[model samples]
Target chain A: MTSPVLTVENLAKRFPTGRSGVFVNAVNGVDLTIAPGETLGMVGESGSGKSTIGRAVLRLTEPTEGKIIFDGRDITKIPEGQMRPLRRDMQMVFQDPWSALNPRMRIGDLIAEPMKLHLGLSKSERENKTVDLANRVHLRPEFLRRHSSDLSGGQLQRVCIARAIATNPKLIVLDEPTSSLDLSVRAEILDLLNEIREQTHAAMLFISHDLGTVKLISDRIVVLYLGSVVESARTDELFSNPAHPYSQSLLSAHLPADPAAKLERHVLKGEIPSPINLPSGCTFRTRCPVAKDFCEHEVPKPHHIGSAEHQANCLRIPDGGNRIAQTETA
Target chain B: MSLLEVENLRTHFISRDIDNQIRVAKALNDVSFRLEAGKVLGFVGETGAGKSLTAQSICGLLRPPARIVGGSVLFDGQDLIEMPQEELNALRGDQIAMVVQNPRTSLDPLTRIGDQLVRIHQAHTGGPVTASRGRALDMMQAVGIPDPANRSNAWPHELSGGMAQRVLIAMALMNNPKLLIADEPTTGLDVTVQAQILDLMKGLTERFGMAMIIITHDLGIVAHYSDEIAVMFAGTIVESGPVREVFAKPDHPYTRSLIASTPEKLQIGGGAKLGGQPPDLYNLPSGCPLRTRCTFAEDVCATPPTRKQIGGGHYSVCHFSGALPEGGGPQ
Candidate 1:
């Protein structure tokens, strides 16, 4: 297999609260690796620290501990000056395209800014590439002259994609890129992302709370709970037979768009606990429907389910007690 | 008789621009629907589609610059539109309760959760404080908030997003309302918490036999939760019917596109005919609002399309309703 484009080891990030010595444990020792041209989907609820991992991987936020190897380089602690050139190989697309882009600049200039800063291309070459990139993202050439405020949400996102691909980065982190869009518009954006992935062969860290979207686009999946990895597996294996209790519950909770689909719901009670004072042992034990007494004190190690690639962090897996009995709601 | 009947409802945003020219945004045009007790009606639409406006018009919640120009909202055989503000005020919180998005902002930051529930109950029911307090605790428990006795005293800021949403639902139930309107109630919540809250609300609605209208952008929630569904476009409901029938055989072009766009049904680069600018409410098209974005628009579509009934209680407002060839749009 080709070398992994991005590998994270024991990555952790904690934000200091108002009270001295108190910190919000956003990400806790998350270890993951994304192979070149592969899409790694990160699924979690709010306060799950999925976005933190994305930001920390790109060094947008400083990590408190652990390592990030991008394209075989340990750039976790690299200085900003040294990281500047490496930035060309890593790109990020945020949730809100409106705020991520500048209102003053024209659409063409916005798409061309990255190339100008990194590629050292002449004016004519940059202009030609900007037009080509616009067409690549299915954006009209006429829209290049218009300002961002004049474009719709879907068009603006296409512009953002155009900018991200302008650098042809090896690693791209997309944090809920389609969450803000309408249903139909979201499908279009997903299609564009899929096409770009096939053409550019860029490894992607697709972080989203929507299971359906993640399942549609990802080659592999990682489930996070309270800043920790709970399960990781191939997309089909994870969706068909999720081993972790949290993963099972989360998948059951997702209501499919089709009314005919049978709903076997295992509705979890209560919300995720505060990140500041996370529950000890299994962070998800508080809400896990099948949690046991041992789950209170002992953090479950990753237990491979069936295949080496499919693993879940749940102690009950050995005894076949991880599956929560789901009630048929349909 | 239906618990609520909204007929030919129209709401307009009449404002003056910087040039002092009067601009009227026909936000809600000829919208109509009905709801019986113990039933859930889902309003599904994109942003600026007048789903919330329909709810506001039903409850007489329209503010300045947004006026109800036409139509009647009848609740329990009485027209809410013609009713005086004093009478409407008494009926709003007591008989018709509403739970909106952003649970944190909807709450009164200064008041404790329990006290807020009690205050709302007292304002509507005019009971003794002790009884109100007792009912407040019962409601908190009813909505599945743990440790209601102590959690009641917790401030709004102390509660999490899901907890705050539960408190809002509890507040809406304090008076045993006949109709509940939840506008994007679970928009910002996680899927797990959203399931819990939706289950709680469904249980409450069945127990109390309260008619509910859940306005949301998520089709998944509507598909599973609602008995009937209404698909809205630029200020108009283009389709309405039983949820199962609508999902099984959608007659409107817009409805077809919406269903085809779902992650389960969508095939990448399969020509789903998705993505177009939302209709400009300020300068809406002459007839069909969706004509600009629709793939099968023809010269005849410039004229207004009349509602056609495809089956029992299944209606689609399009000139070519039920006649369009399957999967024959622009590819």
Candidate 2:
């Protein structure tokens, strides 16, 4: 097996709320490893710390605990000066392309900026590669001289993708890259990302709240609740037989676009509790349909479900009570 | 008679540019649909497709610069378009309630949630204060807000996204409205919370026999929650029909592309007929608004296409509606 490109062990991030000693626990004890050319999708709702994990892995946001090893390098505590060269091997694509790009910069300059900084290339060489990158992302060469403000949302995102791939980084973290895009445009973006992944062989940490989109691109999947990962498995296995109660409920809640598909809905009651004051033990216990008394005190450890690669953090998995009964409504 | 019938609706944004030239955006053109009591109709489209504009026009919610140039919105046998402002104001919140997107911004920041609910009821029904308060609490309970008595005192800022959405739904239900128009109600909400809210709204509609028009960009929401679906493109409803029939056999090219773009059906690099620019509202094409982006555009597309009925009340506004080639699915 090829060596993993990125490995995160017990990653956690907390932000001070200005009230001394009060902090927002954004990510808590997340462990993941993404092999080269693999796409690991992270799914969660708002405040689930999916975005924080993506940012922390790139060292964009400092993790309060744990370690991030990229390409066998322990640069978690590396200073900015030392991290500059390493930045060439890590890239990130944000959610909103309109805000992610500089409006004043020409699209050609923006895509070429990464190459100019990382690669020792002349201006003409960089310009040629910029045009080549534009063609790869399916952007018309004429759009190169235009500003971001002149382009549509879909076009702006294509520019962002071109910039992210300019460096040919070893790892790329995408945070809901297609959430703001329209449906047809979203499919186009996903297709482009898949093609880039195959060509560049870059390990990707794909973060999104949309399960269907995640299922389309990811080879492996991780489900997060509050800040911790509740389950992680192979894509097909996770969708077919999710062991964690939260994963099951989440899959059940997703409304497929097809009207003919049977809907086995487990409409969970109540809202996700405030992340500031997380629930004791299992963070999802407050809303878990099959939560027990022990779930309030004991933090369930990850138990392998079908294989060593398929694991879930739920106490009920051992007793065969993890599955929530879904009502066949429609 | 249907609870609401909108016929040949047309809304335009007439404004002057810096050069002082009159520029009119044909935002909603010939929009028409009907809803019976206890039924749900979904308006699905991409941005700038005017799904929300149709709702705003039917409810008489258009502001300055945006006027209903031509249309007749009939609610319970009365024309809402011809109705006086004062009369429309009285009927709006009482019989025709609206829930917009952004639950936090829609609510009053300074007022407690319960008081806001009470105020809406009083404004519509002019009931006694005590009676209004009782109705507010009942509404909160109906929307499944936990501990209505305690949570009612909580301010809007204190509520979560899902909670705030529930409060908004409760406010819409305070007067037992006959028609509810929800515009992108669950756009920013979590999937689990979205299911809960959709179930709550669907249950409320059935219980009160209220007709609902749910406008959203998510086709999944329309497929399951709405009985009928209207596929809008460039301010016009390109297709309208029963949800099952439309999904089974979409006649419009744009509708086919949308359905094929879904993750379940999409084939990456398989020539899945996706990607197009939204029509320019200010300078729309002469006939088919989607001609500029349509893959199968022809010279004949320059002329306006007439609506063609494709059995079981399913209709498509395209010249080649029934004769279009098969294979919208990913190759």
Candidate 3:
């Protein structure tokens, strides 16, 4: 088997609250791997710590605990100076494209900054490559001269993608890249990302709250609840037969684009609990439809469902009680 | 009879630019639609397409720098456009109700949840506070807020996002509004909570016999919840028709592109043209709003095109609406 491009083990992050010495346990123990050129989608609602995981994986936010191995190197506690050289192989595209980029810098310099800093490319070479990157990401060469405020959301996102791919990074973490753009423009961006995946063969950690968009691009899926991985499986398998109660509820909640499609909505009982004071055992128990007394006392371990690759963290899996019934009948 | 009939609604943002010159943005031009009671009409558009502006225009919620300069919003027998300030104020929270995105902001942080509900009823009907309180409790239960009697006293900040939205819906229902405008109602809620809220809305529209206009950019929510769909571009209804007809056979280029772009229908490498340049309200190009991005655009497109009806209430605002290429296939 080929070595994975990224591996995260026992990943956790605790954010310190003001003066109280109390912490918001944003992420719990999470383990996952992304192979070279593989797209792993991480889906969760707000406060699910999915975004925290993405940032922590890149060391943009320091991980309180866990190990993040990039390209077969354990860089968990690596110094900022040492990580600066390693930054060339890892890039991130932020959610709000407008705020992600520097407003003062022209698009040309924004896209060229990475290449210049990492590869030590000359001004002439960087200029030529900036145009090449722009064309590759479907951004017109003329817009490169404009500031971010002067461009549209889709165009600005393309510039963000251009910057991310400029250094030929091995891993790119996109945090809700398309969530901020319009629907039609989102499709165009997804198409561009798909094309780049083929050409660059970069492993992507596509983190989004929208399941439909994730299903469109991801090879595998990981569902998170209160920062812990509840289920991880092949995209097709997970969609067709989700083994976790949370996964089942999430899949059912997704409103399909087609009007005629029958929706069996399993609207969960309550809002997601606050992350500041998470649930004791199963963080999802408070909202899980089939949660029992045992669920409150036990942190269900990942149990292999049909195959080893498809696993769900639910004790009800063995008893066939994992699936939640469709309440919103057609 | 249609509960709400909006005709040639022209709303503009009359503002001054950074340079201090007066800039008039034609935000909504010739927007028209007829909605019957108990039916849901979904408005699908990108940002700045003026979905919320149209709602504001209909509800008389427009503030200075933005005004309804043309057309009429006739609700039932009376023309809302010409209505007096007092009459419009009385009608707003009663017959015409609006629930916007971010329920927390729409709610009064100072008032208790129950009082907020009762206050809407009292504001419109002017009944005894006791009667209003009784109705408020009933509405709290009606909108699916648990323990209506106790939850009534809960502070607005204490309620979760889903609970807050339900409270907003309950507040809208207190006066038994004839028309409800939910602008991006379930946007910020969790996916699961969104479904619950949408289902609640659907049931409420039927039970109360209200005409609902759901203004949202999510095609998925619109597809399932709405009976009719209006596709807006550059602040105009580019295409509109029954949901089934529009989804099955999109006529306008913009609508076609919209449906083709859905994750369910999009072909990965098909390279469907994304939206064109952002709508420039200040200096809109003459002719169709979508002309800038349309692949079928020609010299004839230089002339503004009127809405052409294909069949079954299906209408497209383009010279060659039905003749455009059918969307969604591996090309």
Ten contiguous residues minimizing lDDT sum, candidate 3 chain B = B322-331
Model 1 lDDT per residue over B1-331, tens place = 8998989999999999999999999999999989998899999988889999999989888897999999988999999999999999899889999999999999999999989998998888986899999999999999999999999999999998999999999999999999999999999899999999999999998899998999998899999989999999999999999999999988888888888888888887787454688888988998788898888899989999999999999999999988988655432
Chain A TM-scores, one per candidate? 0.99, 0.99, 0.98
For residues A23-58, could you state the per-residue lDDT of candidate 3 as single tens digits? 998999999899999999999999899999999998
Can you tell me the CAPRI class of model 3?
medium
lDDT of 1 at A51: 96
Worst 10 residues of 1 chain B by lDDT: B322-331
Q: Compute the DockQ of candidate 1.
A: 0.83
C-alpha displacement of A197 in model 3, angstroms?
Answer: 0.8
Residue A133 miss distance in model 1 (angstroms): 0.7
Quote the true-contact fraction of every model.
Answer: 0.81, 0.80, 0.87
Model 2: how far is B39 from its true place, Å? Answer: 1.1
For candidate 2, write residues A274-325 as lDDT tens digits: 7789889888888888998989998989999988899999988888888897
* lDDT, candidate 2, at B106: 94
Instruction: Give candidates' CA RMSD values in order.
Output: 1.2, 1.2, 1.7
Tens digit of per-residue lDDT, candidate 1, span A61-129? 999999999999999999999999999899999999999999999999999999999999999999999
Q: Residues B18-118, candidate 3: write the lDDT tens digits.
A: 99999999999999999998899999988899999999998888999899899988899789999999999989889888889999999999999888888
